[model samples]
Target chain A: MQELKDEVKKLLEQGSIAGFLGMIATTSGVVPHLFVADKADEIEKLTTGDVRYSLVQILRWIAVRHPDDKFGIMCRACDERAMTEMFRNSQLSMDKVVMLGIPCTDELRIACECEEPTPKSLLFGQSTAKKWDKADVERIDAMETEERLDWWTEQLGKCIKCYGCRNSCPMCFCRVCTLNDDPLVKRGEIPSEFPSFHLTRAFHMAGRCVDCGLCEEACPMDIPIRTIYRKVRLVVGELTNFWTGESKGKSPLAELGDGTFPIQ
Target chain B: MADESGSPFEPKIVAFCCNWCTYAGADLAGGMRLKYEPNFVTVRVMCSARVSPHFIIRAFQEGADGVFIGGCHIGDCHYVKGNYITAKRVAIMKRLLEFLGIPKERLHLVWIAASEGDKYAREVDAFTEKVRAMGPSPLKQVRFWKDATVSKKIYKSEAAAETPAGA
Candidate 1:
């Protein structure tokens, strides 16, 4: 804790970042909050949550509005991945931001089965987890074609279309979404024109999702949103041999010019 | 096979054809006297890569019984590797569809050259049959027919309630 505090102090004292994007315990839940040295005292109450926060989204909001000022983020693997993917897509800039890595606890790790629970830099907390379980994705993979169809139909039927998943996602930074459009998503459906609304989000997140699991958490109907994203990630890994956030400023699979880039 | 209500299965297939190859292939099928199901509504795009997965899903959402992407075969793609990306996407999307409890067969990606008029005929025939057996898409049946009024009412009321932070 002291080490993390010291790093925060050093970062703030450097005057490089305009503010710090992290989280604090609110009465309702742990929510993302922006901390600046002018308000550095608030860093004392900064806390981590078993639940995830959209801290990157908050940083993105400030960064896009004020591109000249750099900011620091206390991000986990998912947050870093989200930021990295966004950066590749030109949504965020690494030049104007400093990353303060925060590793997830063993308890949080088990909850999400995160593979890279630790961040690349500015890491906080003890490393307690390794490896990720692919069973969640494989279970779907193992199902009979017909059975899988039935499963998704039933699951999609429960959708309330609250947009909670999209809203909570740190990487879903689109100014306009086709899912919300009346023509594409057929506005007014709760379960949301199955496959259309969810698949659109999933397809868009193909090279973009950071595997943050916030979408699943924020889903009111408890849809297995991560399953689709994970499958996309796996597909991307196979097709492009690239992982979002593993590198900085790398080109995305969709951007590969005519597949002659030798991605695989 | 008439039950209480006589409802003949007239499946709705949504075909996404690349403007360069398959769309023209479909046009060729029209030029020739190829007889196949007219169930398909063609959505033309410049390239197979331009067909986002959302478009296919949207077709399903909008009452499509089956969705098909007809593109040029791998090496023959006019845009070099456009079909390769389409192939990769189709592979993953088929898996996703199956996971969602929609039969994987409902979504198909076929490489039909502009000259393969007969292949287009066969694909449409097969797809139409497959969709016929699958019956109406569950999404089409539920979102369009059942609880639609209630769902629309809830969607509107909730959308209006969202206020951007600090607004």
Candidate 2:
């Protein structure tokens, strides 16, 4: 925490960034908000808590409209990974930005089942655990085909099409989302089409989902939304020899050229 | 083959064709009067790259029994690398569909150049037979639709009740 404060102090003193993006204590809970910490004194106001929101969405809005200004972001495990994936997908810029990496604590790390809880640069805290639960994926995979289909259909049928899941995801930054497109997703309906609207979004996130779990958290119906994307992530890794945010220079499998690596 | 209801199992398929190659090839097949199944509804886009995996999935949920995507040959994309992306995308989507227990034969990816009119006919004829054998998709199944409608009503009321007055 002390180190992060010092880093923020330096960035503010140097005037390297137009604004600092992080969480501010809200009346309800902690939520992401942009802070222009131009002076050293404002650094005291910044706080990092358990509450999370879609910070990447904010970064995306500012990055597109104001390309000239630089921005500094305080990113944790999933947040940094998400931002990295967003950068690869052309949603965020790496050049006009500074990343203040904070490692996840053991408690938070296990709750998220994060694979990489540390970033390249450490702004605060020491690295903890990297817990991954394959049980959820395995359980779904173990179901009979008919049972699986029925289960998915039943779960998807509970949707009210609030789109809270999509809105909360940092990687879901498409200005013209296909889910809203009439022919593709069938707009103006309750309980959007099963295995189509959600599965399509999941498939699109195959090599791009950073496993942030924001989509599941945002779903009002409490659908196991992360499981779908998590399976896609695994499937892409198995098929294409790539995982999102594992490396910087690698392109998304969906964007790969006509190169086939033998499915091992 | 006719069933008890006398319906011929005419499954609806959506074909995403790249404008430069596959779409022109389809037009060529039309000009040549080559007979193919009319079950397919063609959606022409600038490149097959524009056909996101979501579009194919949506087609199925919106009542398509199958999806066929045709693009320029690997090295011949008009956008230089667009069809390459399409190739990779289709390959991944095929695996995903199979993983979900959707029959692998229901979805097809082919490379058709502007001159492959006869090839286009053969592909469609083969795919039509394949889908015909698979029968109608779950969307057309009466039991599935009945359950879907009932579940949607339950969900609608639950959603309304959950979002209390400005809370």
Candidate 3:
């Protein structure tokens, strides 16, 4: 925590960054705050909080407001991944944003079953890369087709259509969400027409999700939305040998390609 | 056959056909007076890339036993490479179906050129029979999808059951 604060302070003092975005310890709790040069005291409050706030979402919000400003922000593996994917999509200019990578603790790695716990740009703390466990997807896949159908149907039945998952997702950057579109997802419906609603979201996350597990955390109904998306991440890997955030540029799904995937 | 209705179950298949190829091929099949299965309906779109994954998912939710996407051969799309994206999306969509425990076979992608009307007719018949063998979709018998309607119906039923004549 001290090292993080010192790094931010140095960047702020040098006028390299307009502000440093990170978690600030407060009476309420550790909340995401922007620390600038004038108010250097706030940098003292900067601490690596345990909670997984949508830091990328916050960065995008501020970046859009101040397009010309060069900003520094803290990032975990998922946050960094989301930012890179966002940069590739032209949502934010890469040169203007500097990342201070936060390494995930061993406990966090296990808890999130995080695919890649350490970000690309690490400045503080010792970090190690861990392989993602496919326990959830494998368990679900082990069941018979009918049994699996029942399991998912029950899971899908729990959705209240609160849109919590979409709201929490860092990759969900669409100005006009198709989930609310009339013809696609249908308006004024609850339990949201089963497989269609959930599958639509899963389809949209094809090459975008970095296995952040935020959607699963935000689901009020306790729906395992991550399993479907994790499956998507795996499929994207299998089909095109592409992993989100590992590289920059357009997702292969959007590109014109030679027909390699067999038509079944 | 032993059920009260006493009629064989018929599966419903929704096929999205690209206008530049598969749609025209279906037209050729029609012009040649070829007989195909009646279970599947072809929806015409300008390009197979236009068939969003949402359309397939919605078809399944609405009780379609099978969803088919018929696009032009690779490098032969009307818009030049539309089928490339269609192929990729369909492959990914299949994984999503399997992840949800739905049989991946329920969704299929096939390339049918404008000249291959006979092949289109043959593939449709095969797909229809395959879906029929799989029987009615599990999603077909869902009673209510609207939460508000279900809740209101529950309220009314409880009210009626509690006070027979509102006495």
Candidate 4:
């Protein structure tokens, strides 16, 4: 932890970056903080908190105001993957960004079922990559058709229509969300009409979801929102042979490709 | 659930046709006097890709037992890649549908050219029958109907005569 703090401090002092973005321990818990040269002492509290925050989301916000400024971003493997896609999506400039990857503890990796827990620029810990069990997706897949329908109906019916899932999603960056659009989901409905609300979100996540788990964690209704997204991700992964949020390339869904998208 | 008279279930179908091809194809089906099931309502859009995933979901929510999308044959889209995008969207939409418990078959996507009036008639009839066998969409049971106020009321005077205003 001191090494990380010192490294960030060194980056700040040397003016390699105008500021560093990482988690800061707060009275309640850990939250995102911007470590700058002017506030050099603040680097002491720089830590990868016990909980996950979308560091890239914050980075995007900061970059919008300070577009030309180079910034050091502390990232987990998931954060790094998310960041990579953001760059690919033109949400951030790669040259303006420096990543200090924090390899997740094996315990955290296993708990998240994270396939790759080591970012390209590893600051610490051993590289660990393994497949997620996908038990949740498979369990739902195994259900009888009627049973599956009932299961999803009950699960999605619990939605309070809080944009919590979208708000927490690293991939959901659209300033004007389709969820709020009329004729898609009516304005001011509590249980945002069954299936469309959730399914629309899953469809949008098709080729883009990074399996970050933040949306699932943010759901107050405990909807298995990530499970649906994982289905789309796996579908896209199998079809395009491109899993998003990993190594780079524009998502095929993001454009009308050379007309040879494999459609079965 | 059946009607009050308990008639056989007739599945309501919503078909989205691309303006350049399938919509024209449907017109040809009529010109040729090709008889197909009258179970479908065709909504024409500028292109097949214009049918957003939510449109299909909204179709189901509005009580369509089946949602069919017909676009120009792959390479023949008037916009060049609109149908191609439609294909990709349908692929994604189908997966999400299956995961949400709707049988993937309930949502059908096909590439039919403007010259393929016979194909249009045949495919729609086939899909209509397929949906009939599947019975009502499980989603139809949700019965989420949207009501809009009518600007003109036909029975205002009659309603007042039938009952006291307070009553």
Root mean square deviation (Cα) for candidate 3: 4.8
For every model in order, the TM-score on chain A comes to 0.90, 0.91, 0.94, 0.94
Candidate 3 per-residue lDDT over residues B6-118, each given as its tens digit: 77877789999999999999999999999999888779999999998888988888878899999999878889877878888888888888878788999989999999999
lDDT of each: 0.75, 0.77, 0.83, 0.83
lDDT of 3 by residue, A1-264 (tens): 677788898999999999988988899998999999999987888877777788888888999999999999999888999898889788888999999988876666556767777777877775564667798889988999877876777677777888889898888899999988987887767656777888888889989988888999988888888999999999899888889988556777767666665664
Better of 2 and 3 by TM-score: 3
Given candidate 1, what's the lDDT at residue A46?
A: 78
TM-scores vs. true structure, each candidate: 0.81, 0.80, 0.91, 0.91
After superposition, which runs of candidate 3 have C-alpha atoms over 4 Å from their true positions? A105-110, A127-131, A259-261, B1-4, B146-167
Q: Candidate 1, residues A1-264: lDDT per residue as tens digits?
A: 666666776788788777877787778888778778887777777776666778888888888799899988887878887888777778888798888777786567677767677777746565566567798888988887656655665566578788888899887777887767785666775455656777788877777777878889888788788888888777776666777767545545555455443211
Q: Would you list the clashing residue pairs of candidate 2?
A: none
Q: Rank the candidates by DockQ, best first.
A: 3, 4, 2, 1
Task: Please give, for residues B69-148, the per-residue lDDT of candidate 2 as tens digits.
Answer: 98888778898878767776777787666656565678898889999998999899899889988887754431233365
- Against the true structure, what is model 4's DockQ? 0.31
**Per-model TM-score of chain B:** 0.82, 0.82, 0.84, 0.83
lDDT of model 2 at position B59: 79
Clashes of 2: 0
The iRMS of model 1 comes to: 5.3
> Candidates ranked by TM-score, best first?
3, 4, 1, 2
RMSD of each: 7.3, 5.7, 4.8, 8.2
Q: Rank the candidates by lDDT, best first.
A: 3, 4, 2, 1
